[model samples]
Target: MRSRQFGPRVSKDGVSFRLWAPAAKRVDLLLDRALPMQRRDDGWHAVDVPGLTAGSRYKFRIDNELEVPDPGSDFQPDDVTGPSEVIDHGAYAWRAKDWRGRPWQDAVFLESHVGTFTHEGTYRAMIDKLDHLVETGITALELMPLADFAGRRNWGYDGVLLYAPDSAYGRPDDLRALIDEAHLRGLMVFLDVVYNHFGPEGNYLGHYAPEFFTAAHTPWGSAIDYRVPQVRAFAIENALHWLADYRFDGLRFDAVNHIFGVRDEIPLLHELSAAVGDLATETGRHIHLVLENGDNRASMLDSAEDPPRGKFRAQWNDDYHHVWHVMLTGESAGYYGDYQDDPRGDLARALSSGFVYQGKRAAFWGGEPRGEPSGHLAPSAFVNFLQNHDQIGNRALGDRLESIAAPAAVAAALAVTLLAPTVPMLFMGEEWGSRRPFPFFCDFQGGLADAVRKGRRIEYEWAYSKYGDEVPDPLAVETFKSAVIDWEARNQSPGKERLALVRGLLAVRHKEIAPRLPGATFGEARAGADGLLTADWIMGDGTRLHLIANLSASELSPPRTRPAGKPIWGGALTDRLLPWSVLWSLGEV
Candidate 1:
């Protein structure tokens, strides 16, 4: 029931409209008719409409010429370019009113894009598959960005309206229903939010409030200037809006390294974490905050804190993914090149410590040292995954690991990832080995569409040369269609086997590993000369979890160190470790 400065505030006196437009000479509220708004100090324009209420559609006419949707509109029934619709947050009746969310250690995430999750691609449609996820042993459903974009389809990253949920999906209540249903089924829902920069199209802020953005630019667009109090409040309130208004279990911040802050000033990241932490404490909710920071700032994470205490619960461990990827696919281009030099060793480091590049120089990262030391953190501080949206979608062809890596090798990787003490995440269809390409697709039109096409072509020139005319067009409707996973595949031959494998692995993770993951400590891990990997960890209950893997194509001699306790996954310890073999065990420490 908290009021936010960024959006329309619904009260007993009706709807109060507010806009921050310092540069405009006059701002008018366009409802049934254009009405003058009082310009207050600090560039805020406000008007109290006594008769207006929720579901009222309105826009702001700037200087009597340009009318733009509210930047903080809760719902955009039309596309982002159309008029904004007022939404009363308290209107929807939540079914899971008592859902407080699950703990961080129990999290087994399945990252999904709601639009491509099913044929209908609506929030309500996604509810049908919730049972399948529960059966497959997924504890959490992590959705991609939902901020209103310019068109009918997008990856959801190029979101211009940070507050509004895109109309292409469904109404605001539909999304709430999805979350409500997820909680009812005991599944936590986390949203992937982009606060680094606004999308390229349908952004009208620069026309009126140019101070919202900095002169600098991110990889996507102009960086937001968070130094301004209003700009900072906008982002902070937006984060809370998702957590407080929608009741999401957690949030994954996308590309946070781009969100710049000064040393003297309290960084926006710290302030936002503090605000979220306060909410969690006040509400007595087990809210988790995860980051996708490329900087590998271990200082930002503190799993020890109950309410987070201005720190995040975990970070997406790209280092774990990169090393496994290099070992499986033999990729040596771009960032993958960093792990190619000693992939086995890198994997060992990732398995032992939280990060592989702990102040070490990375060849792919301009030969510069990156990441802080992360060995002291809890094992749950890193969210490990073999594949994610960026790892697959950013590829020139959007090829998944199962498509490129050997089947046995892929299975071995999954066995290690799923059973490890760290939290594990899966891309939507990975459990069923869905090979449908998740190519980068959008619904941009006109010059913006042309620019996107050209950029994709340029960025993937090598791919174009190799598969010319075969690469899916970024703006075509068919391209988006191709990304929709085949649900029937789940019941098919190999898909069933893969799904069973993941389910069994996760069953062990939840039963044996998750309960003892609280105070887990990292143990030593090493790679031998003959495709042999040995690692161990001490669980919170003082149980030792050990792993032994032989990743090469040929049989290798057993390591001097054998698995510790009862055989959890792979068959009994053999005299000779077979090719692509992986074994997990748990013993008393």
Candidate 2:
């Protein structure tokens, strides 16, 4: 009820259409033909067209000149530019009627992109791969954004129709089927949503309501005006639609730092949290909200107490990824420079506490203080990943770290990511070490096509100029095709080995570590004279777990005294660790 029902409100008897276009002098609902709409006092236009049921496609004829898709389209069956369709969400018979979803304490996430996740690149095709997800020992599947963007394929971040699922992936029912299957397989589905800037093409919101976006800046062009009432309502309502209508387990809020601020910002997140909290209580389902913030706004995390009350349940921790990436690859760029001063110390801090900056002046921010201390937060509130869509695709060539990092070093990073006390999300194809590159790819309209092509080159303008175009054309179909996971790799040499290692580590984590997440704690990573990074920590079961890794190419001696508990994993019990190796001990050392 936060947002006024903006789209067609489906009914057994006809349908009622409403739209807010305060700027428009005339607005009409154009179905088979035009039906004039009466202007309302609340800056909205209303029209009740009888004999219209679900699946009836219609466009709002604004100013009696241009007919465009609904601002709150439930489904864009044809594409982003197509007319919006009325969908009866109650039509489908969903499975898992009794599933309450896996909680944060036991969540091991699989972050996947639907288009490139499989050969077919549809929701039905994605469901076919659920077996691998279950085999990977992940409890949740976090999909990249699926909102309707322009053209046939995209990263989904450029989505304009915020409520409609991408038609490229299949109809609304297909997506629903996929979620149902995932739930049946005991995998909670989380959607990544972009609420910052609308994609360039076919976004008609500004045509009707120009106040949707504000003057604030975001990494993705411009910021959304969270200060506007209807805007806030639309945002919150969209979130609830996903949670209540589609029955998703949670949402991975993309780029939370960009979504609000420059005004009373916290209220947006607060109100959303309150609403979702209420929805959970009513449905007897726990719907989690996660934030992605480079600044680590740990203060926004919901409390650790029972029936937790507050904002988001967790946040993606970039500090962990930044330090880990540097430690393994020794490649530091951009914000990574801040941790180069004491990578191990920073890693240690990230391990023990959730944030490394903690209200201190950030060297990356030109010594401006950022990110309040997160020591008070529970470890589960910090999501850790060695590789994600951005870490891999943002590269000029979209090369996975596995392509460059030493095999052993990659394995060590994987172990740390999964074995750590925090929530872990595995990028698609990461487990089996698929050699495919996940390059940035998109399909845009003609005019925007050239601009997007140029934008890709200019995204890292220096690379395009200096490296002489290190990236492939994002507009090319082959560029998208090349990113698909080679399923054959799972049966081959190094890929098989990598798969075994990943599965083995996940098995160990699920059995020994996952249950302890609610109480697990992390300490800082300390370095020894031999260049080995070591961290001794306590698990939820009061058992001591010691992590020691040799990231260098040469073999090194182990600790003077063995780790507490027996070596549950790795060569921790031995005196020497092979280059780029790690040891995880469980019993007293």
**What is the number of backbone collisions in each predicted candidate, taken in the order shown?**
0, 12
* Candidate 1 error regions (>4 Å): 262-266, 460-465
- Show pairs that collide, candidate 1: none
Residue-level lDDT of model 2, residues 1-589, one tens digit each, is 2434767787777889989887888998888888889997767899987788898999999896888999789899888888899998778897789988777777888888889989999999998889987887878988899889988889989998888999898999999999999999988999998887788888887778877777777766667887888888888888888887788999988877677672256477778778888778777886888998766777788535333345788888888888878877777666677778777777778877888888888766778788987876777888888889988887778888888778877888888778877888888888898779998999876878898877777666533454565568889999999998888898898889998998888898888877766666655567764568788666678777778887677899877766667776785457678877877877642
Instruction: List residue ranges in candidate 2 displaced over 4 A.
Output: 1-4, 262-266, 303-308, 363-366, 462-466, 587-589
Model 1 lDDT, full chain set: 0.90
Alpha-carbon lDDT, every model? 0.90, 0.81
Query: Please, what are the lDDT tens digits per residue for candidate 1 over residues 223-264?
Result: 899988899889889999999889999999998888755324
lDDT of 1 at 244: 87
Q: What is the Å distance of residue 386 in model 1 from its true position?
A: 1.0
